[model samples]
Target: MALKAPSFLADAMLGSVARKLRIFGFDTLYIAHAHDDEILKMGIDQGRAILTADKELFKRVVKAGARGVLVSGAGDLEDLVHILSKSGVTSVDLGGIGSRCSVCNGLLEEKNQEQLKNGVPGKVAEQHREFYQCMDCGKVYWEGGHLRRIRALAESVDAKLGRAVAT
Candidate 1:
């Protein structure tokens, strides 16, 4: 059987980290105001590894037959990404494929130039023809200069893990 990509349930404390995971096309769920117990339950129910800064929460969930990561600090997103990447808790699939939405966890749909004219800024719509939209949240996305920044950050985390930009 093929191994599936690891899914994650990020606690409220790691909201920014969750966003970065989603930006990398990981199936990360972020519950902004979730209680510790609720977050643990979500991880159990969804079979998702829990990522939290709270050590106690990590201990609690890991004891309950779930995998988790206890983040050291909340200073930087890049650090968090590096820690998680090194832990081998999640695999980063970096082919720039449509996997997850940065805004919402919904799957992304490829959209052509004509489809994005009304959604994005005039400059972006005119300049970039290729685009993708999130089905659940209707947010538009495209490969812009920011993608290069994200790729650089991922490379900084793991040179081999930065495959998302090869597309």
Candidate 2:
């Protein structure tokens, strides 16, 4: 298997962005109440690229000699994607969708029906044979309509970005 790209450390306000990154199978570390210094420290310590919505934090990361991506206003993904792409963050290494846990940022481990029976409802278990459990949070996930919708959205975003870049 190809090695995944470097992980990310998202600042407090960027939690939603972090979740979206996980949905794309990226290892994104999110902290809800992190100060700029703490976030930068963690990013450096963990060898993670810092993601922030604050210009000061972005500048700090750059000054401190750390890799970072400054997401534009309020975590809009198109802008985030654009900024990340500019910093060499591409979908080429993003791997399969939903491969990481949106909740705890853990890798999703494939689990059979029996392993997830307790967490899943009886009807769901009977209907679905495949399941994935978050290795960190134990949240159970199944391939249903949401997965398809998210995937479609991702594809659309990619296509739009491609077109925008080509112009």
Candidate 3:
């Protein structure tokens, strides 16, 4: 099924994976020190797929009728992609390419010219007209050289995963 929010609740052991999922534009919640019950409850309550390394926990959540996936035998990006593939995740939302915030999991909104004058540096304000600001954290995003690097990295990851790079 297509997820309503396309979000994941990753357990403490999968903190890095959760962060990378955010980088891939997926809304992921990472709680480094939560109990199993708390993790399962919030994940289910929020309609997020539970991603965990503990096989027993995975079984319990799955048996409870919660959508989940057991992550084991790997701890790298490639492994994460593979594990998530079972849940229908792909390269459609590459980092910074999609609307989700890279830092705060907030929806990014386009900032007007007037709003751009405040927090944005003078040089950046003059150089780029199109800018996006995070609704939750108030962090700004711009189309710059760094964005190109993100694009390149996304492309590389997609290519490595043998999937088409998102346009």
Candidate 4:
């Protein structure tokens, strides 16, 4: 059997990181107002590794026998690289992009243009044929200019990981 990709529960300070992780096809739960206890319980119950910038919380997570990573990089890219590296991901798979909901950490299902009548704007429908809807939040996603940016960011991440692995 194939090993499952690691899932994550990011702390409040890592909200943006959580969204990015979801976009990269990783199951990431971001609770903006959750207490540390809640975060720890959820991470353990759901089998998710806790990602946090808090040194104390990370220490507690480790003490509790839960998987956790302390992310304290200066830039968003650096943080992402750190998290991915800690998770054993040496490269980003572009194919996994848009596989999950960036907003809700939900699975995305492919949707036909005709299936969504009023869900998407008329202009967007004309510009893109492929679409995806979040099974949890009903958010629509398409290959807009954002997709290009996502691809570029993924490439940069891959390059950085490559350099790290090489040396």
Models, CA RMSD each: 4.5, 2.4, 4.1, 1.5
Q: All candidates' TM-scores?
A: 0.83, 0.86, 0.74, 0.94
lDDT of 3 by residue, 60-116 (tens): 898889888888847555556665566665544563464767666787888876986
Candidate 4 global TM-score: 0.94
Scored by lDDT, model 1 comes in at 0.73
Once superposed on the true structure, which residue ranges of model 4 sit more than 4 Å away at CA?
Answer: none
How much is the lDDT of residue 66 in candidate 4? 94
Clashes of each: 2, 0, 0, 0
1-167 in candidate 4: lDDT tens per residue?
A: 04578899999898878888899888898888988999899999999989999999999999999988999957678988888888777888889999999998889999999987878999999999999999999999999888788778878887898888888
Write the residue-wise lDDT of candidate 2 on 37-92 in tens digits: 89899999999999888899999999999988888764345755664565554443
The residue pairs that clash in candidate 2, if any, are none
- Deviation from native of the Cα of residue 103 in model 4, angstroms: 0.8
**Where is the poorest 10-residue window by lDDT in model 2?**
86-95
| lDDT, candidate 1, 1-167, per-residue tens | 13566778888888777777777777889988978889988899988888888889989987898877777665545545545554453444556434568777888888997766688888887688788899999988888887777776655554433432332
Which parts of model 3 are misplaced by more than 4 Å? 1-5, 72-76, 94-96, 160-167
lDDT of all predictions? 0.73, 0.78, 0.74, 0.88
lDDT, candidate 4, at 12? 87
TM-score leaderboard ranking: 4, 2, 1, 3
- Candidate 4 lDDT score relative to the true structure: 0.88
Q: Which residue runs does candidate 2 get wrong by more than 4 Å?
A: 1-4, 92-95, 161-167
